[model samples]
Target: MKQSTDKIAVLIISAIKGGGAERSVLTLGQGFHELGYKVHILRFKSLTEYDLNPNLAYHLLKFKPYKLIPNERFRHKLFARAIDNFIEKKIGKPDIILSNLEPSDRVMVHSKLPNIMYIIRNNISNKFRLTDNNKLENKISKLQNIYRKHPCVCVSKGVENDLQARLGPHITSTTIYNPFDKQLIKQMSNELYSTPHSVLKPNQYIVHVGSFTYQKAHDVLLKAYAQSSKAYPLVLLGKGKMFDETKALAKSLGIDDKVIFLGFNKNPYPYMKHSRGLVLSSRFEGFVRVIPEALTLDTPVISTDCPSGPSEMLPASSLVPVDDIDALAIKMKELMAEPQSFRVSLDESFLPKNIAQQYIDYLTS
Candidate 1:
């Protein structure tokens, strides 16, 4: 594959937080850079939690304060205009622009930018239900308009289906799974921890890596773990506003001793590599990156058959219904009793190079 030395691709997102969407943007940016496309990242905020490729150019936009405006729609429009002006001044126009999340996508759509690709990162139906304000009807109307104006890319087929259902079938879109860096994850997993933590004892615990939030359904995970008869402990990795509440839930269930909370480890691959298995109890997902990451490491995985991602990635046997404590417990116990029986095959279609090339082809087309 010959490198495109003259092409430039700009990736726009809210921030470089340690979430699946943010990580996907970073991976795509790195892939484009490796392919000799001059890549740039335009983020809304300056706070970065993940490491970025040094070759990629980074730019931050400072949004104007609109606290006086009570209507979020107006505020968003104002901020979108500000972002348009910022891009014009700082980076000018690129060969292509890949924007992530609703805010960035809305901005790009409103900007009337050519060769813009909007990446939808979650189950839109579930996310709107969780975060939508009183103007629900109006919100959907605006989203439908945005979808009609741009070429959208969803992280999974489930997400794509949900989006078309919500915005009408005429909305132009395609599915592009999130890319994974297998070599990087494997290398990180092999690196010795500077300070070894006792909670990471080999084959002694099942691991769940995600934010402790309502969407992640940590409460359901705790309840399932309590119901299961498995002897291995459960480890929760990552931090969120619901940390204390989730801890209290574990205590209330009388399984605090068996549950360990290791808040936000930057290198969770080492822990994932040594764990008995990885479990995802998300209420919904765009595409569960951890499932593939675990499979790449040969770790077994069990996930809730949520709205968007799990059913697409895992076999029916490895999935249980969302928030179904009894079924989740049964699956957990089954995996624990015969861990080797539930290994998932990693899909090579999501390799970084392949997905990146798809993006290039789409943008150029």
Candidate 2:
């Protein structure tokens, strides 16, 4: 499939939440825009946590009446219909549609739009395991059937393999790693903060940036940090439902004084740049964006060898067994002892422009 001059691409996701999936969608939109395509982001709501590209257009599916309906199934059906109508009337038909997240994917699949590409940004099986609701399970089962009928993009080889194992090989899918804008990260990291965070002392603290959640396994990180002999404070960035619980865990581990909970900072790049090292303790991830982002800043990283991403992004020596407090503690100690020795350049394959081209090829193909 050759590129068309008048191509129009529409990227759909539930909302602009501060997560890897949202960031990936934003990066892809920018990529498509750079390729001379008219990019439009179709979101279900107007709520956003991350910044959007100025070049890309934005469309919203305004269906507030769906909330009035008491029945869940019928509400979803109406929501899907509303999306289809909005796309037809407001945006018309796009040359290509890229859908992210389950809610948006469900609507896209239900719309039965042509040239629809569903992006699997996480380990679906692990996500499903995170919940036990029968209704949600049924919804996911339906989404899986819809996913089978469309071309899909997985963020990593491990994610691609996991999807195939669950949905079978009949599904057409391709692996495209997430893009990292190294120059942009460096530029942002250099921006001076009006008020410097007191916790960010020079080479005195390691950083961990992610939502405070069970999947991130902050407990494991806290336990590991507690066991380690390093004196550097652990600075945690990002907020979530488990923020208080994680704080309590740190206190219980007797490392509260050494751990600084900064909540969420819009610009964590500066912190990443100044930190001695970054740590990711996810139990499973589709792809850990922080790994490459940290490496881009010339910061050493120690991560758990989770199901899909850490091993793929970091050297084997820098990865420890998942959820093994002792192993993570040992790795943390080694990293803190010689953080400079562990620093390595990220592979050029993850360059933003290169990965962006891969997306264009996949979408066009």
Candidate 3:
């Protein structure tokens, strides 16, 4: 058997964007670097928002499939080969390879790359939106084809179970929650930061930090916020395609003035640190990264009991049913009426070093 430090880990993703999964993937790369392995992040795009550690190797490919190739499977094979050639020439073969997100998963499905594991970041059933049952089944079949090849690592047990139910029992999978830089999160929580929009006042606002996506269910959040006792101003701290539409919905709900959109801030910790509480009203999530971030700051959080994460992270008291506006509104009011003495501790296993060990154990097993 090889020593742990002798193993090389390569993580492939689209890019280092401002999404939750990307954030945790970067932290996981850092964890591998800290464990004394030579780590590399091979990405298909050059986009980056977060500061990267200098110790880890990063290869920016900015890849696009050649549409000239008629067959999708054959095209993916060539794409995978291009990546494999670069890895062999520049960095040698990775001892273990892990793929993230859909684009990367596409090539990795046909990849002859060694010891590869596909990381399922969300609930498989909710992976797409389709009205036709046949279309949905076709999409599910595509995913089954990709994930069927390798041993999988899901971000939550809920995701693992979803995969089993959706894709059947042929594949092997396990749950490994994303790693958080707990110390960094705690330190950043104390930071004095500024946003282009209105300045955030400490202990005076309820914060909801997620992109304006269908999965995030911001409409539900806004509707529920309007019905709540209006105890605190709401701060939304991310941007998406539905941002303008969501803002319009806020006005339609007559709570536009009470809701603040600061777009996407790289450091949302300062806001989380001083907020009254953090709220997540999602339809589904791989796992809400902010729940751990808020808990690291000792701030309370309320989330919809969505698939793949909230239940694993928060207690029953802090959860509400998904898409239930009335229940969420009542919970919000209860949160405000009760004393703000909620103290919760996130598990130490969330720390990057420990989470990295879980990955190592899984890959080496």
**TM-scores across all candidates?**
0.92, 0.92, 0.94
Sorting all predicted structures by lDDT, with the top scorer first, yields 3, 1, 2
Q: Number of clashing residue pairs in every model?
A: 0, 0, 0
Q: Which ten residues in a row have the lowest lDDT in candidate 1?
A: 191-200
- Higher-ranked by lDDT: 1 or 3: 3
lDDT of 1 by residue, 145-171 (tens): 887887888989999999998888889
Cα lDDT tens digits, model 2, 96-171, are 7888977776666667567788888888788568566866667566656878878889998898999887777778
Query: Which window of 10 residues has the lowest lDDT sum in candidate 2?
Result: 193-202
- Scored by TM-score, the top model is 3
Q: Report every candidate's CA lDDT.
A: 0.84, 0.82, 0.85
Candidate with top lDDT is 3
What is candidate 3's local distance difference test score? 0.85
When 1 and 2 are scored with lDDT, the better candidate is 1
* Model 2 TM-score, 2 decimals: 0.92
- Rank candidates by TM-score, best first: 3, 1, 2
